[model samples]
Target: MSSTLLFFIVLAAMALAYYIGRQRAIGVVGGVSQINRLHSLPSYYGYYAALLVGLPAMLLLLLWVGLQGQILTALTLAELPPEVTADLSEGQLSLLTSDIRNLASGNLMGRDPSPAVEAAAARFQQLQQIATLSLWALTGAVVLAGMAWAWQHTKPSFRARNRVESILMLVMILFSLIAILTTLGIVLSVLFESIRFFQMVPWTEFLFGTRWSPQIALRAEQVGASGAFGAIPLFTGTLLISFIAMLLAVPVGLLSAVYLAEYAPRKVRAWAKPVLEILAGIPTVVYGFFAALTVAPFFRDLGQSVGLDVASESALAAGLVMGIMIVPFVSSLSEDVINAVPQSLRDGSYALGATQSETIRRIIFPAALPGIVGGVLLAVSRAIGETMIVVMAAGLAANLTANPLASVTTVTVQIVTLLTGDQEFDSAKTLAAFALGLTLFVVTLVLNVIALHIVRKYREQYD
Candidate 1:
């Protein structure tokens, strides 16, 4: 509810900002009729003002809302009996806060609500409502203040264009700051949880150990029991499956993309691109079922006929299905990047008596290498993060072997298994999900970086 209100508040502030900015620019230009004489267009001034007044306020609102919930939770906890707070872990505390919020909204269900808890919940609700109202009022007041200040400074002699440009520059800075902050936040969250996981299991074991067992017993007596924390098998399984998927997807997708971008007739390209994209439009879960029910069985029988041991649930089947699922990603993105390569490069190659294939391979693709690698890297990340296909068709056994006929498990599958069903929150099994998530994030990041580097290096050779 507060989020929804904050959105409207920012929108209203933006509207007011646009009006103020436009009025100021009009005054400087002598009137709306003189807009053509101004240093910048009237709309730019409005947009500049809208960005200026709304961005800072929106940032403030976001920061305030983030902190406010935590602050309210702490206060509510402090007011509660010591016994209630004593046994609560961080996860439980979060759950408690959610319950309080539910109770405050008169929607508490399951188990009779305690009187004291109910009272605290009601107060929290009242405080949230009051805070929301106050924030909206304060934001409106600030908008009005800014508008008045701009109006007073607006005159025929005033430099409204310069002011608007300055505001526009600041808005761009804010946007860049937002992107950086978001990336930083994701990395830090992963790093912190990975550190915690490492503390529980030796970093050496996680990095170098070959065995990948992570099951920990539920009781205190189970501490120091035999459970391997090695991640090698999981890593190997991920690599093998991802490799197979990529091998299947890349060549087909790239050729399709090239044909569409460079040679296909207009009607064919138009119909082909969207039809290819429809492959990506299908849900991954649907692909999972296709892998499990159809592809896996078909492969198992085929391998059996060849007198080879093919597991009913094999990485090959999952990888094949996953590859099909990723074809559209590679095709769509590669098409865009291929099309972006200057057509002059192709013309130059053709003038040298090079065939279309030779031109694409030697000139156009090299020029578009960075974007192509970017697309492939993105596809690889999607393959690595894929869960449903591996869960359904790839076996749960964490086999380190790379043979396509054998069963294998991926990191995402393990994470799902570890966290599924009723379980103790602090258990290493539950925390392993966060650890796996952190590892997955790092792998994807590295892939992206390497892809960018490869693309850059390759482009420089030809460009």
Candidate 2:
């Protein structure tokens, strides 16, 4: 249903409750015609009654509808024939339940159904209709009964507003608790998987091993194969790519942001800002292919022409393209933050005869550094977690070398290769992806914490 329609329904119900409550309160007062004799000034009692009736019913309806399909399917299975049940596996049974529900809802078209199945479908349809009707009636009855009870309890000394406020506070706390619990759940799940991976492969071996051969043959007659879970190479690759990307991105991005924020004409900025943001809107996969097809080969030929040995899939190609892709990331955020710095700081520097660049370096940049650093940290996290560009342009070989000309593999690339085209889930190979994930999470977490701390410290200086 549309929100407007739902809201109107609730408003109408509340209005009815308010009118009924006021009339009932006046009746309870008997011969007292004084307006000041009211228990809760009528409106508070109405709000309390509406909240008591509407909130619980709405909650129940939402919960029931959310779980209705699953509960009905479970109930239907209990009523199904034993022979039909035995013939279906768990997955197939779930599919059958879905089909039956579809048939019950009159959504399935053009089927010549057997009498037995049709009868069952008809019975299910009846049950669903009855359940929906009963819920609506129950909601209305409960709302009316709550209104009547609250009206009867109305006394000159009643504290209905305080009661309603307490309930609202409880609801707010519940919402906050749910948000915190969800974040905790995600952290715990990652921790559990990391623990499982560590149990399968020793923490020391996984962390320090240099070779990453994650193959495990399933057959008994398979030839000798080694699987190593060394993460050092992946970490090295991540750093190399991030370093190269930062080299290309930071100077160009920061310069552009400074130009836009400080020196651009108003008319020019109006057009240029959107164009810069549009760069960010382009998909990363497009950049990946661009790096693979155009940049890598161009760099390879360029290196060969200069008598340098550069791999076709070198870190420079991936990093350069990835850097171009991330330029907008730095520029957009930095531009906003630089603009947000108080103009008084710039005016003060100008009063002392400081040039534009000097003012920016001394006052504006320092003031905006927190926001800029946050943007850079976010971009770094993106570069670290990037998978597609590295997968295509960077080679799969886990070279521990940091030379930009040499090919290297990254942590994200290894995780992708490990999980894709899977054989057995229980093997060390699959579990190793979790270990890599945990490592990635921890590294990103530390980077964020340090960035935020530095930003906070710098902010205090300016303030």
TM-score of each: 0.82, 0.78
Error of 2 at 225 (Å): 4.6
TM-score of 2: 0.78
In terms of lDDT, model 2 sits at 0.81
Q: Which predicted model would earn the best TM-score?
A: 1
Write down the TM-score for model 1: 0.82
lDDT of 2 by residue, 1-463 (tens): 3334444565677777776666665566663376467656667766777777667666756675677666666666677677766878877877667667778877864666555556667767776766666666766676677766777677666777787789889989999999999988877886887788888788998888887777776677776656777888899999999999988888888999999999999999999989988878888889889999999999999999999999999999999998998899999989988988887788999999999989989989889988899889988988999899998999899998989988998999988888888346577888788788889989999888887887777765654
Which has the greatest lDDT? 1
* Model 1: per-residue Cα lDDT over 210-276, one tens digit each: 9877776657778665678788899999999999999999998998998999899999987988888
Off by over 4 Å in 2: 1-54, 86-168, 297-314, 395-399, 405-407, 420-425
